[model samples]
Structure formats: structure tokens, C-alpha cells
Target chain A: MIHLLAFGMIADVLEHPEKDWPWSADTAMLRAALIKAYPELRDLPFVIAVNMDVAGGEQPIPPGATVALLPPYSGG
Target chain B: MKNIFIQGSIAASFIGESIAKHQSKTDIGAHAIFLGQVRADVIDGQPVSRIDYTAYEDMALQKVHEIREAAFDKYPLTCMHIYHSLGSVGVGEISFFVFVSSAHRAAAFDALREIVDAIKADVPIWGKEIFAEGQGSWKVNQ
Candidate 1:
């Protein structure tokens, strides 16, 4: 199992960890973890804000300390 | 410690109060201020009515603290402040205010521009443009 966390919006997953995130796992396993976290958002249009800019365009999130799901900031 | 975030219809008063609190010092030769206001504009043929701003406060505060340190190191400034709105700001309303006080005009000008540019490029605030023509779009400081 992998650790996953979300802010601004939740992910689209059917089987979320239901526990703490930022855990460890391999690349494929973590993507599975993300898929589990937000089943609804899976394969949907979304962006991640690592620090200030949008990230994770097409690739699965890298297993590291510099990754975040950037929920679309709709507030003006 | 210093007043940074201002909201609602009273933001102007807050800006005024901040300015009033500044006393001209004989050692400082220049004081520069920049205020960014919400403007009604056209976006992709739609007219924007206002903007709503949101941010990750924890990260933003960390960035702001770094900016302060960098500004003082780069410029001979006595003090500086940055204020940004947290919610919706209607057209013609002020959304951001940056103030810089330095011992010289050149340093103050350079520092002011740097601060604004850094905030635009590095801050984690999101801007949603609400249109008067009944449409809207998300915009990031680019």
C-alpha cells in the first residue's frame, strides 16, 4: 500500500487508504494508491500544485517529497 | 506581527492605516508603494467583473518570510510589507498592496519590483476571473 494525501479537493478512488498519507511505495504502486484515493477523479482532468506551479501533467506522481494534487483554484 | 491580510470593504481603510503608520525617517530617502486593483476586463471575448483569490496560507506565509529576508539582503531597506486579499474582490477594489522603505531611491525601486515579481511567480495563490458576461476562468500569475 502507498500513502496519498489531497487538498482543496479529494481524489477519485474506490479504495482509499483510510489512514495517513505520505507513505512509501514503488511508482506503479503509488499510482494505484492515487487511483484508490480518488476514484472519481481518475483519468479525469486535474492538476497538481507542487509548490506554486501546476505539475503532474501526464505522468503519475513521482515518489518523492515534491508532489501535491493541485485542485483547481476557482476562487478569484 | 505586522498587518498583512485585509478583507471586505474595509481593505482601503486598512491600507490607509498602514500608510499612515509610516513615519518619514531622515535616514531613508525614498518610500515606494504598489497597489494592484481588480479590473473589469475582457477574457476570451468575455468581460471579467471581478476576481476571487485563494491561497495555501501556510506555504504562502513561508514564502513571504523568505521574500522579506531576500529583500533586506538585496536592498538597503528599513522595512517592507505585503498585503493580499483572501476572498472575492469586486472590480475597482484593491487586492494586493506592497510597500517598501529604503535608504535610497534606487534600492527601493529595485526592491519593490522584485517583491511584486516574486509574489507573482512564486506565491501559491489562485485567481478566478468572474466575468460580467456570465462566464469565468481560472488564472495564475504568469
Candidate 2:
């Protein structure tokens, strides 16, 4: 399991195995893997974007990859 | 070459040394410096005391590189440096610093302004304003 670094909110990997990621999982099987591995993030109000693209459908985060969990940016 | 971002607090010595390093170039006759300081502002009947900053580091570094390139191309600048805080900054603490050196006053002045504007608009950073009374809110540049 890769250490997911999120700035604001915590993501639970124990609750949802078959469900797609909050944003998008790259592969159908990978989506299943995430939910199975981290089911705790299944119901959170969060969005996942890769390279700033919000992945929404059945895409899984590429295996062995790291991504930023950006909710929104507001700074002066 | 001095990297754009540093982990420690920005001291007056850092600013002075950065300027002194470029002094060897006699062609550079002028240097402009800008520092952005945090202020405790009242918001919704609460007083803000500090800020916590975070960024999309990879994206921010890329944007800084692009700004440096564009600044040199658009103006006759000998060199420049930009620094910003990535973590918590209290009231009266400095958060942003931009320094520009050029052959003349006009170019340095213009380039300094451009760099600051670009940093505010292009950088993927976020700030949480901490209030003196123990409350906070997300802040956006106006």
C-alpha cells in the first residue's frame, strides 16, 4: 500500500473495494482493489483529480503512482 | 544558482545577501525588492492572527521556472529571485519576497511588478487564516 498524502482530509482505504475512487480509477479492477483496500473513503465528499483533471468515472489511480489530493486552492 | 524556494523563515540577511551576490555585475545598475507581510485583519468580527500555507509543490516550481524565463525574455533583467512561505506565518511575518535586477531602474521596477502578479495568479497555493480568538478561514488573494 502506497502512502497517500492528502493535505486537508483523511482518506479511508478500508471501506470500499469495488467502488470507483472518489475521482476516477484508471482500471476497472484497480477500482475494485481500492475499495477493497480502503473502504473508509467511499462515502466522503471528496474529489480526486490527476494532473488537475477530476477523474470521475471508472478510472483507478494508476498502480504504484502518487497523486495530490487537492480539494481547492485559496491563498493570497 | 539560488533555488526559488527555501524552507526556513526569510530573514533580512537573506534579502541583503541575495542583493549582494548580484553586486559583482556592474552592468546591473538597479535592483527592486518587494516583500509581502502578513497583517492581522478583522473578518466577520474576528481578528486574524496568522496563516498556514500549502502548495502543489511540483506545479508551483514549474510555474516559478516559467515566470523566471518570461521575465528575462520580456525585460532586460540581469537576474531575479522569488521566495514564498509554504507553512504557517504569523501576523507581521513575511510571506512573499521578489527581487529583480536589471540594467536600469525602469526594467527592474516593471519586472518586479510582473513577477509578483504572476506568482499570485499562477501558483497553486492555499492559505488558512488563523484568528487571534482561535478561529480560521480560507483566504484568497484580492
Per DockQ, the best of the predicted structures is 2
Q: Which regions of candidate 2 fall more than 4 Å away from where they truly are?
A: A1-49, A52-72
DockQ of each: 0.23, 0.30
lDDT of 1 by residue, B55-118 (tens): 6665567767888899988778988988888777888888888989877789889999999888
Going through the candidates in order, what is chain B's TM-score? 0.88, 0.92
Put down candidate 2 lDDT per residue, B10-129, tens digits, no spaces. Answer: 677888888879868899899999998888878998988888777767767777888899999999998887898878888887888998988899999999998898888766676778
Q: What TM-score would candidate 2 get against the native?
A: 0.71
How does candidate 1 fare on TM-score?
0.70
Residue-level lDDT for B19 in candidate 2: 83
Per prediction, fnat is 0.16, 0.36
Writing each residue's lDDT as its tens digit, candidate 1 over A2-76 gives 233343333223233123455433434554656685566676444544333343343444444444454554322
Interface RMSD value for candidate 1, one decimal?
A: 4.4
* Weakest 10 consecutive residues of candidate 2 chain B by summed lDDT: B1-10
